[model samples]
Target: MGERLAGAEKEVLVEIVRFTQKNGLKGAEGGWKDFLARNDKKFGASVSDPKKRTKDVLLAFLVTFSKDFQKYFRKLVRRHAERRAIEQYMNEFSGRISPEQKLVQLTTEHLDYRKNYYFPSYQEGWKVMRIGKVSSSMNSGAMLAIDCEMVLCHDGTEAVVRVCVVDNKLEVKLDTLVNPLKAVADYRTHITGVSKKDLEGVTCSLVDIQKSLKKILAKGKILVGHSLYRDLYALKFDYSRVIDTAYIFKYANLPTTSTASLNSLCKSVCGYSVREDGEPHNCLKDAEAAMNLVTAKLKHGFNDPIEIAENSVPEPDQMKLLAHRIPVYLPCQELLKIFSGNPSIDEKIDSRIRGEFYSTCISFNDIDEADKAFDELDGQETKDSSGRLQKSVLLKRDNGDVAGFFVRKMVYGSRLSNSEVLKKRPQPTENTEQKKEDANGDNRKRQRTSKKHAKKAKAPVVE
Candidate 1:
């Protein structure tokens, strides 16, 4: 009822409301002063005098528009909140969406109820939210293969001296020598080919390496390597998303304690040999080898290597030998009689005598024939003189290869004869006792000599 704002006045008034909403009037010591100072040129003579504008025109406009300004600000905030809710809902349901569905159904069809009225298709929604791109200026969370080289530190613990990271395409992304925090005890030149000279000018610290790795490796990235746990432990990293080649090529026939060697797995599964150049292990080469194995595995759909190996069908002469264990007390004639019953038992099974154990290496025409004999002979019981049960058990090799059987006596663990047991037991000797006394005497004498030398060395010498 007082006076309507002119066109220019209205525009200036709207700008003031927006500025006040963005930077609130409360606790804003010079907020009004700043606003006036900034817009004085734009408003010209109308707002040139701060007191006249505030008392005559601004006070009335502020009283009227304060309510409308709050409403306008709240609407903007609501719109922003709605967009965030929509983004969160889309991300939560992204994995659950079926391929054929064109649009994803929201939890509530009433957009106002859920506060996210703008529900788009999965693809379009992701585009709107910029979901695929990371805000960080680092590498994306792509699969990476990594390997590390270690040297024995002065404390006799292995420390990472070199680290290498490669992408899925076999491109080397990071390869650098890391200077150890402690003095190196051993160069481990035979394995790592790293010597003291190589680290003479090295300046990269472990923290620096960690920072670089963090830049390249993002969260949820799958790290590929052979024995990645050891490398991660050496790096002091706790990342858990990993694909270990050792685990993927774990020997199926053997116990979980056994794992295939990276070199062997590469040769057996990928039909290529790695680290055979006799040079120290190259981390980049190792990373590439691991990546190649993973690629081959993916291409072949991860078929079992045991099935493939057995299908090749090796010749009788080319068949691998199997090792078995037998009771040491079993007489040679009795052992011959036991094996004579089985037609598959090769005539030339090799035997070796150890403490309380007799090991036999058996060969067969093929793996299938050997497995058949093992199934029949394994767990078979034989009767001793006292009518006690002595069961024969097959032995599994470190690579999950089962080749030999051992006789297990129920009452006594081993079948060693009394004479064999007596011979194997440790016997004290006078010479051993004398040697200990001599060592003590020599240590005392050396200590006395060192003390005497120390005193003499400490004596002041005149210049």
Candidate 2:
């Protein structure tokens, strides 16, 4: 029994070693097989029982195979293989998830939602996501700030991208010239100082950059320079959790501020010295500046750390305008028009309609917070030209209150066209008489005050 066990153990080791040696033997491969054959007799009798001996031999065969071709196996199971598996899983899961389920997930997991985060309209509801505050002690989700610098290609139509990511420190994600499929006009000289020679051997397609960006975005949410709208417009990413420094600056109410020039903000908030280089744009540097701005705000007050003024209430006129544009939540129309030249209307409403309607109505107040909601709504109206729908709208304001109003499809189109009703009014609602009286009165008083100011400027009176 002892001899058999020793023989079996020796067989296993020999098989492992022989397998490891076979591939390395090159054209003169007889050395590995010859060595294995010489040792086989010693292990063949290691197991006395016929069945046990065959079983041991089989195991040894597998072990030998693995050891001999371990390099090939390792190559097959690299990161690329793992990524293929991940993509397959994502494709299957995406196909299985229903639209309702996607909506629920977006609301409960994907958004930057606080406990009482408001939604002003049903359309804006999609942007809502449940977000939990992360504690520093627990290292779980990490936020990354990314900036991409682009250059114009010689073809007058592509951009070279230099991407940087900021987690705690700055790191380069990608540095390459991307071929933007559009024309590269002379205006590109302002951003990318790339001459024709510089673009040689350094050009890649927008598709290549987009594929790379998709991989990068898949990893995490990226804070971008304030003008994220333009960047995202260029790249195809439903950019997740993007905190635009431009939007932040606007929300934080910083005057004479822009993300393009980082020096002013850096000096005020992060105390970092940054010098501009005339080389092709460095996106990584921009991403770092954006991250630093946010970090400073999170560490200190918005003003002291980010060099922005404290949050001040908007003027009354501005507040009134915001209140006007807040989305009115409405139920999904039962009969969605498909434009097949025939209308199929479903009059039998779902039993849950009332509950769903109420829930959506609650979100309308939340949509009111965004000042630019109207402009966005205009875009949506253009996209969804079904022209058969119900829109919850702010009613004519009377007695210092905006009432609820519902305009059917045809009515909305007419209302939109009527200059008298849709005129850009300075105030929400005022009688024509009141407007005329103010215009006449203020004009005379302003003219007299201007004359007096001019007279005073010409001759200084001695007191």
Candidate 3:
């Protein structure tokens, strides 16, 4: 935000300045205090020192003489933003000393294992070692892009077999094969290039590499990689600082929440790809590729290397049916009772997962059966153990406050089966009273027509 907060700062300040000019300082000050209170947890933690607001403070900011205060506010917002997003927070010039403002900064705090670690946090082996990835003393803007290759362990887990690290200058800092403590289940030689021969006399272990990485990543040094969290997990370090190129660049054609591959990003963003076709995975080239991607993004003024302004990514298109408004406590057997008499419904139901709500994909024999079931089920609420107004199944939620269960109709590409037991709805029969009324109406119309004809014949001829 240091470089990008130019127009955005004024865009926000204008609203405050205008509100103040319209309603005086009291309104502005009250609004400011309210905003600070609302975002205290998110923004307050970023500030190293806290201070109270004064009349002098407003005057200094409005008069543009508080350069120190302005810088502090910029850093505060930037630091807070770094926690919220990674795209704009990380930017760097290749082979040149990056300015403090443009450097990619990360929180000094350690990340919990719930996200990156494949196993549970309480597991004893989650952390590679007791040493933290970053310390308070190191505040350098340097980065080390890394890549790790893995092999299957006897315990049915992946272990790091090869590790590679490259500096911002594309210089290889460390590249070596490791002898995993566990017996190798599969060398995955075609990909990792580590065979039985590769580890023949390998002396270094993961612990040795961990000690070496502690020195390399120590002192607040930021790490860079493509999907670096996976590498961090393989290495078993909860490294706090990282700039992942997967989240930084855009291919524009992929899922919006998803990202492009390292090779794809490298080719599109840097006008070149590190690994060529038919080549096995190379960690050194991959590390260099990731660094090149970040520097390219930096060159483009922190914008995506390609034209991403079009927002050409299409929305997901698919039909989903569901029985909604059912409480979590509703058992699968009780819920199935609702679809009992409707022979249209298939017997398969998925109610295994439970939370605040419970629902299963109610498969119908055909589209007609599905539509018939939907008409009866939509907006019907399923009650809990206590008898209440809980009725039938549903598809969509009429209220934003409500949650809905989405049953995918076309799962994969399987076609819906035709049910031989389809029961056709009976046709409507004509009513006897309707027939009697039609005869009576015909007689009345005939009598009126006859009277009119007789009058015309007798009197209208003389005229």
Candidate 4:
């Protein structure tokens, strides 16, 4: 019923369709221009009005072809399935089916997905399970998933209060409350579900828990979790051979700097949601959720474990300078005023304000000087002329390459005396002659000579 395309036009249309399929819609515009350039002879007559014949015609063809392609693809899938079924029937009639083949067949049938889905081979799976230790006696079927909960300590730092570990079958291997070394400042009841009452009678020491964990996480076990870095950091444990679901589903379309949350990944990839229903989080449940998400990925054709190194925050070197506890509202000029006496020092200030929180980064000239200043002024709080308390503290950089002192307040204590601070310039060496030559050129002479003019001096005195 529609107008028919010419032979040459149809050929070009096929090429265009192939290109679109290979590169998607984003590359279609440039691909069409390239197609025209390559097949200029065929489109010679319509060169002047290329848009009408190329883009316009190709767009219409694509709209029609897309529907047809879907149907064609579905038909191909149906044919493939029918072929596979026929082969299975032939094998059954011949009575030559192997036990391994039968197991695979049964597994595929239960999952209702193609057997080709990317899942680790049996050997690979076992290898992932036994990652850290070296022992021939380790079980090949073992797998681990871990999660931790923290409570606020008296000094406002987070300390691990609860930890949970689960196996491949989602069986709880370990779940225990930890007695923190410091006094509990906040139970974090809403999120951690741990209250003062729960911790009051808790007797599990951190050392005992760590020893128990080391045994369960023995060699040849694959560890799975979401954002495992935070959990490991809280535990102060170092581990390799991990599958982080967050890293697994880190989409190329999203910003490279950010990773998707486990809740979002589970809902999007596994068709299920977690951390909902307004209930307090249980570490065991969270660990199970991570394991389940990985299983879903396996069923959908993700085979390799997303192994990542333990992301340990490196301690800053002694030469590094860090400043913290600065008020966010302080301007750059006012911040620089803190070290105005040290003209030899150069500095840069970075500031950001988000609602009530203010953050600032101040970089200093040299690490040694910055270190000196940090030690002298770190914890000492002072008051301004207006009687407002001014607080500033020195911080340590996680990355030494980014040299600076971070501060939250602009106020600093009195400037260091000249005796306390190091001089920027070095003292001259013992070579006096070389020093004199270096300071003043050889041809330059000092123009200081006392002239004997007694009579002229007397005349001046009379005046």
Counting clashing residue pairs in each candidate, in order, gives 6, 19, 2, 21
Error of 1 at 316 (Å): 28
Q: Give the per-residue lDDT of model 3 (tens digit) for 24-94.
A: 23332243334344446666423211133333333333434244434434433343344334332232332
Q: Which residue segments of model 2 deviate by more than 4 Å?
A: 1-140, 150-162, 181-183, 249-261, 276-281, 301-463
Which is better, 2 or 3, measured by TM-score?
3
* Clash pairs (backbone) in predicted model 3: 138-219, 377-393
Preferred candidate (lDDT higher): 2 or 4: 4
Relative to the unseen true structure, what is the C-alpha lDDT of residue 210 in candidate 1, on a scale of 0 to 100? 71
Instruction: Show the lowest summed lDDT stretch of 10 residues, model 1.
Output: 120-129
**Model 2 Cα lDDT, one tens digit per residue, 1-463:** 1233223343333333333333333212233344335447775333322233344543343334333343332322232233343335435666553322222223223122211121111221122221222121112234466655555545743343444465645565666655454555443554654444555565586567667666654533333453554455444333334555544432222221112245445654567644343444545666777767766655554532133221112122121111112222422231121111222232222211232131111111222332333332221122113322333443333243433322222112212334633563245468998899899999987877877676644322111
- Candidate 3 local distance difference test against the native: 0.51
Best by TM-score: 3
Per-prediction TM-score: 0.40, 0.34, 0.45, 0.38
Report, for every candidate in turn, its global Cα lDDT versus the true structure. Answer: 0.51, 0.38, 0.51, 0.49
CA error at residue 129 for candidate 3, angstroms: 9.0
Mind giving the per-residue lDDT tens digits that candidate 4 earns over 276-342?
A: 7456788888899888876776666544322111121111222233233344433334444444224
RMSD of each: 31.0, 26.5, 19.6, 26.8
Model 2: residue 427 alpha-carbon error in angstroms: 34
Candidate 1 accuracy as TM-score: 0.40
